[model samples]
Target chain A: MSKISRRKFLAGSVAGGAAVMMTPAKKALAAGSFEGFPDGMGVLVDFTRCVGCRTCEAACNKEQNLPAPAKPFDDYSVFDEIHHGQPRRPTSKAYTVVNRYETKEEGPVFRKIQCNHCNEPACLTSCFVNAYTKTPEGAVIYNSKVCVGCRNCMIACPFHIPGYTYESVINPVIKKCIFCYDTRLKEGRPPACVESCPQQVMTFGKRAELMNIAHERMRKNPEKYVDHIYGEKEVGGTGWFYISGVPFEELGFDTHLPKEPIINNVKDFLAVVPMVLAIWPALFTGFHLLATKGKSHGHGDDHSHGEEGH
Target chain B: MKKLATYGIKPHDAEVKADGQKWSLMEKLLLGLTLDQYLDQLKRNKFNWLLALIFAIGIPVIIYRFIFGLGVVTHASYDYPWGLFLGFGLFCMVPLSASGFMLGTTVEIFGRHDFEPIERLALLNGLLGYFFAVVYLLVDLGQPWRLIYPMFVSWGPAAVLFLVGWHVATYLSVQVMEVSTAFFEWIGFPRGYEFIRKGTVGLTVSGIILSTLHQGALGALFTYAPGKVHPLWYSSSFQWIHYFTSSIPAGLCMVISVSTIVILTMKWRCDDRFINNLDRITLSLAKGAAMGLITYLFIKLLAVAHDNEWAYIATGWGAWWLFEMLAGVLLPMFLLAVGIHNKNVLLCRIGAFVTVFGILLNRLNTALITFNWQLYQEIPHMWEIVISITIFAIYVATYRFILNRLPILYQYKAQAVEEGVAVEAEQKAAVNA
Candidate 1:
């Protein structure tokens, strides 16, 4: 420990000569300049364009190879499905769901809830088993093999997207929309849900391009969409952006989500780990030595007294 | 014991039989009752039937969970990701298990050997509490079989659960080693006991280290969800301290509560030394608990003040927080003080019961009630209730089993006699062989 401190001073002078190379690239890109890889695709869901057709729901079920629902996909009555008085969002069996929210002024608004695939996704960061991965192409994929089912991701996701199929005994994985990374998005095609939407509510593009298009549509007809994009800066932005005519809060969005990803707040505590690991052993050992100094070894002869009578 | 009896030895003069012989292993194992009588006694106890009923339901529910998944047993709602299992089992159980280290420090580290008679009891309490906490965690986990994945298969060393996983694993082992010393003594493994004794300082240090990290890390786990946990319950800076400090009281009070239960229901299991020393030990333990409660109270207030949550005091949630303080913290603080000052064993016991309940309420509040503060409240499913109660019953049954068989509250006389012979042989060997 003493020698390292001494060598640090010697290394300081040597560090001056190699300063430029050692510093590495301080990439001074403009804030938000990295709008992800240029070809990285995203989905823009325009609320005004959606007609609650349920075509996309059928397509998604088939595309994901999920189990068929109890009710037929053609049945729009599936929108009224409720559990514990609240409408179902998503489940291990259903990665995406469109729920009808009736407003007094606006009549009814159908909102689709799925994994937002955040730029800095909470589920990806919170997973202790490294089960989640955010690709450069904007899809957040999960590796089920490594998943321990601690459900920290479910707890961390602000959108509450990850669903554990708790009923599956043998193979339980966190089920969520992966933006069709393996099949569709990787091929530069839209997700099956986007491609199957006959109402044309869903639009697929580059995330940055999608954001611009969402804002442009809202600007052209302010009355048709809310002023804000739902996923614009939520938890440090998401691949999916929503344009809702009704307030996002009323549409079951978590309005209280911090602008920064939840992992950012946790960094403060994580930063302290190294400091503690480096300090506690030495510090406490010193305290022990100091506290026990000059005390005749107590209890060396009294191990027998630990017994009393059964 | 058989080896010791070969040389005609007895642990204590009082343990000698009328025939001038030591009790056999069978007699000790059955507590001097014949096998038939012991079985009859077990049948006579209604609690065993109740435990059997719980195991019948719970063990299967647990198996079904592993087979079906976490969704089968729990609602598995995204809003309430953690239910009764983590809330009551992991969070509540771990703090209660803090008794082992807290007492171990009092007697071993601080050199207050007066607490020796009850030390093994405290150690057993801690060991069992932690052991069962892990059992509860296994039942709650989505993929219970891959629990080792976090440790070996995949490492998210940065995550708070990472710390919890590693520390709990390490601390559980530490506690096993700590508690096993008694088993070594009981089983007449003199060399094993000596080996463990030599490493006591190192073990205690590691215990303190692991206890500090894991207790704090459990609180830090909540830090992952800043907005999810309520403001009053959420303090980024002080939350870990709040948990760690409160665990001090929780652990101490747990030992008190367990001792109280044992004295009431299993008095025959305790030897006179334990029963006689228990009241004084309870008072001493309460003193530590009071100190912990006082520290916990101040830090809790500091968290509230740091967050400037004064306005929240008028709300319903604030009232709930106050209820937690009154029952869990302030009331116990006052009761423990009064009990210690007045030397009222009953008051100390009452204080302990309150503190234990307070700890439970605090954990439950953090994990369930105030979780998703803005979201609607979640009433656990009826199935969830049955499962939680059943697992708790299993915990109680296992605790009773160990208390009945192991030299937890009582010493094993046979081991001591064997140890006496071993010491004599070792001395003779040093002189001759």
Candidate 2:
């Protein structure tokens, strides 16, 4: 064959291979349009009703069998403490913590931050080792066995909930609230924090139903609460929804977050992966042949002759 | 070297030894110095002692990290997810190691045979840098043994990490293949070297493909955190491009830096061809890096423009961004231009070093310093610093070892090369005719 024909043939084959590799991903994307599991469970937090009593904190601690906090949950002094100039969210030590936002207009609106258990959770999607799993019941749980601790999920998280036990010498798992999935939520029971709330601030139900209930409460009490449900459309809709009299941003929510899932940001790159894999062998092989066509195969052979010695 | 008196230490010198006696492996390994002289040279370099000190202190800490877990070594804050290991090792080191593919393309594939003298050094530098980056990653991982879990255990096909994991693994192999030819030359294995050479086009093409994907994949890893990585530093659509493009200069500048350092420190080990061509190669490499930096600068702005991030430029992060641009991108670019214009290799050398520092600062900023701009800044633990420096010391040591022995700095003339050339022609003829 002429050099041109060979080059054309290789390039054509590579293009064909790339097309083959990309077809499935494109098909999957066209078919999968983020229709979340319809019956997924969710939590609705009425921030207006929360008094920062720390009842939910104590309940989460008790249910998870976590180490006791330095101060008692009843000691209200913990609420005033701030680290890194921001209110506390979930940590390895604290699975769920309700931070009190002292708003000028709304008095005190307590916003609870934990794993939003996003419908399309970044944590679940970013884990390379399958460390995290988002169950149908709407809890994102993690396994420590395969956790490499690269912490890309920590970077990916919009709410910044997953905490690593850097203090542990061995088996430092990512610690976060599993929404009581293992012990309670899976059995159709409310999470420990929700069940333990004194003011009934948390309402647990099917995620789709809870969203409707959140909208209903907002409509019924338009004068009493903010119109927004914090997690309803944030990061592709989290299972946890928050309603407060104060604006969501004031309560330390990442209001700038896009409505699409974090994984959606990576789709453009992932779409190219298989294409490169299938096309590169032929593409570069063709380049090699074309570049070296008229030149002596002497240098090329000399090159590999050198490689084998290693 | 005593064996290379007139040849100098550059790669361009085609001078045959006056007596036509090839230096044996042992003499080359000893830099043509006898055993005692080699030992005396080792004792003379105080930097070796410093490296010893760092490993003495840091190696134990690494062991401690493995035994006790990452928590003992790093602050392990929930907010600051990745600390020194990832911030410096994986993120920074990978880009610097882009030298392999960059040089490989220049010397081998594109027929820029002028770069052949310094090509092996660049390839060795890349291979060692990447190998050690993985070393640091192993220390930082919670389950270091299960590092291959992404490949075999359970795959998260859709994850950005899936891309990073697969690409890094594959790219590491491609680099190994690219570097192996030098090893084969050193070891006198003609067949192995010839086999790999036959696959050169395939390997080089694979190198480009792998380098492009993983370099971009590293940036794509950040896309998973749109809200966390500052808007000025992060562009969802353009982050991959910024990283991939900057890496071109970053990798090229790294070759210039490594070559410069090798010439200055290990001149004795380098053959005449490498030593004589060092200055010209440095200037040429700097020119390439300058173009890369200019492209990088334009793309960074384009990324900002694409995102309409004009508002971020006025903030403190913007100032930080400008500083990165001024020092990292623009200053080296100007210096490189001047260096290339005046044919001043020293200025090009300086430009290369500056560009290297700039790449380091950029990676550190993206991975550690400016990550979670809204969150508090984290100072890496003392142990973390110790381990990071120690690993870097090991990288330098390995690089030196390879440069000393491999045909990277000095080509080997062996019996097989003549026969191998004939064999290769036959193979090509068989394939074509």
Candidate 3:
């Protein structure tokens, strides 16, 4: 073959290689179901076994070095405390809180609330500064150093998990549970909260394994536990799954949250952002050229026309 | 010599003293009035006193907020992370400022030269609105000084707010360039003005692109809270489109409203050209706004149908939504249509005001009122309200400051004459060389 034809063949091969590399990545984004790391650890909480002992809450506070709470952890009276007609939730001072729900079927049910560390965490996706990172160990952690403190993550989190230290006049940042990534989880141990549970309420292992254990528990005790495992499909699955005797909704869980990832709601707009960026310049510029085609030479007359009404 | 109204300072006329000395910058700032006349004007206006009182009460509170923390001024509920500063200041102001791109597209892209008189005003309006929106964001952000982290230090490419941050920053610069031509002329820099004028089409096109994405992105921001925002207000698929489409009318009506205010209160500042064409332009803008409202109304209904949220309209929140539609969307549409049909400038101005108010209501609803519908309602703390008003007052003051000096409402004829003289002088120098 001639030198020119050989060069053409080489160029075509390079272009084809580039095309092959690009297609699958784009397809992955379009598919949009990220199940996270295969061996990522998760916690399976059996709410039926919880005694509302507040051990997990105390353990989280101790492990996270959160500020002293208004009331001591052993004080059961704290459960009755309500603000704005809502039960106590995790605040900046406390990374986890247990709330007691008086259900019709069950006398009392306790649900421990903290960051679910979702497979596609909304807080991670919504943060503009990339402050958040979902670790391979299934811990969603945030870097306060990069946080602009926009609190957009607070707005975006489906679980309303991230809390801000608004009272700090200097250097306020988001405060939330990191699933004990720094202390225990990174070392292949369960979180302080999970380990501290007296009744072995939470079983910690690989997420896929935990899902199986949760289902197996439900299968063995069909009447004692709900047939469904919370967080298995909630917000595209979460690191923390819950099985309860009472309905999840009765315990203030947002049951209506879409099974798909929260970022799915924003994908339509994200898809259009590039399209507008790509199309609008050429589109409007073309209009400008067409509108002023022959008038370019007579641009001075355009000013005269502007002056006519004066 | 007959005293000229504030608007009567023609470009060619030397604003000089009786001694023929040029007016100093201070004298220009005083609106060409003697110290006594300026003071007299200030005292005579009760509105000025009211503004003064607001500043006195609110400015200190704003300072206190910075010193103490957001918790002092705002309720600072973690459940309600955003307050009036963002809900009202950022969201409402950005859409209202959309006038810049809309008018720029009309004149520069479509060649609607008749709209040229108001184009600078619209551009200035856009620039100031976005500028102050950032100001509000700064005040609201906990680490306001670290704002550039999103741009330079950290990159969150997947986030919608990341797109918003980059786009708003870029669009603000684009608007600055578009508005700077008038500033160049006002400052007697004909060459600078000419340079900017050459890039008008490119600037306008970029403005359109940036405005479209960011405006829609603002709505898409709410899509993250699908269960939080009321179903009537939230449609996963159409939220961005709703926000973008509604911004068209919101922006156009703002221009109409601002221009009307200019014609009424700043008549002395307006040239004969602006004065003569104000009513016609207002009507034309009203027509555009009406069309935008119609389309907005249709798409809103379509969204409800698509989401199967028709059942939501009968509840109390539904009633509130109906009121927003009727007063903000439907009523303004009807008024604008009637005003345009009959050429009633007064009616059109009223419609524009109503439309602007409606847009504000919609933004407030989406960002605050309807936000966290399942939770308790949050009324802004008194100091928060006060600070919001104070910031808005500053925005208005800045806007007026620019308008009172720049050749925004009037053409700068002196710059034109200066350009002609410079060309002749250059030609002579070339011949000599």
Which candidate should be chosen as best, given TM-score against the real structure? 3
Per-residue lDDT tens digits for candidate 2, residues B283-320, read 88888999999999998999899899999999988999
lDDT of each: 0.75, 0.76, 0.82
All DockQ scores: 0.27, 0.42, 0.34
Residue A200 CA displacement from its true place in model 3, Å: 1.0
The 10-residue segment with the lowest total lDDT in model 2 chain B: B7-16
Better of 1 and 3 by DockQ: 3
Better of 1 and 2 by TM-score: 2
Candidate 1 deviant stretches above 4 angstroms: A1-40, A218-225, A298-301, A305-310, B1-27, B43-46, B56-72, B411-433
True contacts kept of 1: 0.39
What lDDT tens digits, residue by residue, belong to model 3 across residues B1-433?
Answer: 0122322222222234434566567776665555554665566667678789989999999899999998899998998999999999999999999999999889877777788789889988899999999999998999899988977898887788887887888889888888887776555566786666655666677778778888998999999998899999998999999999999999999999999888878776787778888999999999999999999999999999998998899899999999999999999999999999999999999999999999999999999999999988999999999999999998888898788777788655422222233443443343333
Which residue pairs does candidate 1 place in steric collision? Answer: A166-B69, A166-B71, A167-B68, A168-B68, A169-B67, A169-B68
Off by over 4 Å in 2: A1-31, A278-283, A297-310, B1-35, B415-433
- For model 3, residues A1-310, the per-residue Cα lDDT tens digits are 0012223323432332232222111121364678878989999999998999999999998998987888899999988988988998888888899999999998889899998999989898888888999899999999999999899999999898888999988899899999999999999999999999999989999999999888888898899987778899988999998999989999999999999889888888778765766666666666765776665411331222124332
Candidate 2 or 3, higher lDDT?
A: 3
DockQ, Cα level, model 3: 0.34
Residues A28-116, model 1: lDDT tens digits: 11123233455557789877667777777778888899999988877888778776567877888888888888865587888887788
DockQ-superior candidate, 2 or 3: 2
Off by over 4 Å in 3: A1-31, A296-310, B1-23, B415-433
